[model samples]
Target: MRKLALIILVAVTSQTTWADAVSDLKNYLSSTQSLQANFKQTVTSQQGKIQNSSGTLSIQRPGLFRWIYQKPFEQLIIADGKQVWLYDPDLKQATVKAMGKALESSPAALLAGNNQFERNYTLRPLPSREGIDWLEATPKQADQSFNSVKLGFSQGQLMQMELHDNFGQTTRIYFSALKINPKIDASQFRFTPPKDADVIRE
Candidate 1:
């Protein structure tokens, strides 16, 4: 009947739309070798307190990233493929850890590393919002630090990410002036402790 045909058409259209979103995400992840973006991060605590931070983010594929927080406070988190370093200028201290261990439960790692997405996450298309194609990713491991992550893309560019932590805190990051596949110097991911600073290795 006409009603049955219409139902089938709607179902097919929905499926195609979902597939397109997933495909777009996969292609973006596979093609992006390096990226730079300015970001604003908002964190809401379980008790409803809110905090805001603005930062610049840079990432090179295969386990390299630098997150520089410049406003409110200055902090640097750098992963150099082999090790991860956390530098706090105010404290004059740095902590170093093996990269694998540092990325174990990190959502940032998911964004920066060349991870096998399908192997680690179940990806599904979220209803489009604000003219952005949204994808929701749930970790295969039940012990993940965050409950789930949502990624939003506009015109094939990553624009936003939302992470919900196990502790009920939610962090939302909005990206602006994003540059994909930009040339990044090798030294960008490297970190050296400053003179007279405390360095702790784990």
Candidate 2:
């Protein structure tokens, strides 16, 4: 189970480095105004001694995302690219981000207008395998939470990911059953408060 969770996390959020040859990722990202993919995640802490809960991630480029935790307890986190919304069913409470990016180094930020993402980070390309290309990025910015992020792509579609924190803690995710360019409903990115839910504006 520990292995599975870790693998899932690695697969869903995998990123490391990439080759600038052909603007490899830039081209694929440029082709679509919006995109979405599924993800599985495992987080290990204590310098890689403990296994954290597994979860799924839903991503919509240009600043919309949903991360759902399916293990341990169910929790929902929605970010419309600008602000964040977190809902924990067990607690029946939601935290609203009045402002600011909680996860500023979020990879989805790459989906935003091209601002030379490499300015704040160094990028490298890994050899392709299993029909998927890999890239590892190391952020130069000091305020960010994690040490590095790895992204995986299969024929231009993001398939998996892995994130390693400063403490040697790693979170891996795998994307499966992916669907791109679907007729996404309007309600997908919008987050409204739930009745009786606490709204904290930070």
**Tens digits of per-residue lDDT for model 1, 27-122:** 777888899999999999999999999999899987899999998899999999889899999999999999774364456656786657777778
Q: Which of the numbered candidates is closest to the native, going by highest lDDT? A: 1
What's the TM-score of every candidate structure?
Answer: 0.89, 0.74
Worst 10 residues of 2 by lDDT: 13-22
- Model 1 steric clash pairs: none
Question: What is the clash count for each candidate, in the order shown?
Answer: 0, 36
Candidate that scores best on TM-score: 1
Worst 10 residues of 1 by lDDT: 101-110
Candidate 1 deviant stretches above 4 angstroms: 1-17, 101-105
